[model samples]
Target: MSIITFEHSFFTYPQQIKSLISEGLVDFGAWYLMNDEQTSRRFEGLQTRYPDRRLYPFAKRDDNDDIACFDGSDNTTVHVIHDFANSGWEQKEIFPNIDAWLEYAEECNLQNESS
Candidate 1:
């Protein structure tokens, strides 16, 4: 799989995200982190779709296609954007950094396995 590296032009991924990608630990319960190529496409698509928001999409929910992206100006902050919103799109600050997001993802996986 294509991993985000320093050469990536879209955005400089925070260390937490880079480490996870390097380790090949992209899957987290219902979410799947996009490879470098997918991320590039997703970023370009979002730029056209929502010019007002600067999002660097890295992961997405399999169930509803909610996007997990980093703030363009600040790679550390992560947000989940609603892709299927009926009355336009909505976004929420779900994690302070990629590390927190990974923790949440791992927790969800554990919960799923328990069930």
Candidate 2:
């Protein structure tokens, strides 16, 4: 019943995503996916706009891949996982949109409340 709020959507390669999941950092609860080009542009824009914001690239496949995951949080925060390809990544089955994710979260919350 936890609610995860994202100021932006994250896009990365398969291996990095897998590592994140394996590390228990981001659980596949709910998530959104943007195309690689869109993600790159957005990431660049954010970097230019907010130079002070510490950006951590979430790369797990030997750090040579063009794909990257960025973390702009202070502590290790959980993100809803979505759009994962079957490249040896393990995650919980969940929807791939904000509305559906929120709906599921709300349902779980309501169930907990009733119980």
Q: What TM-score do all the candidates reach, one by one?
A: 0.79, 0.29
How much lDDT does each candidate structure score?
A: 0.75, 0.37
**Which residue pairs clash in candidate 1?**
none
- Residue-wise C-alpha lDDT for candidate 1, range 1-115, written one tens digit per residue: 4655534676777777767767877778788888777788878877777777788888887767678998768888788887545424567547987878877777767777898
Alpha-carbon runs more than 4 Å astray in model 2: 1-31, 56-69, 72-115
State which candidate has the highest TM-score. Answer: 1
Error of 1 at 56 (Å): 0.4
Q: Give the per-residue lDDT of model 2 (tens digit) for 7-111.
A: 234533334344434465443222223333445554575455445543333321221222223445522332232223333242233344333543555564566
List RMSD in Å for every model shown: 2.6, 15.1
Q: lDDT of candidate 2 vs native?
A: 0.37
For every model shown, the clashing-pair count is 0, 1
Q: What 10-residue stretch in candidate 1 is worst by lDDT?
A: 84-93
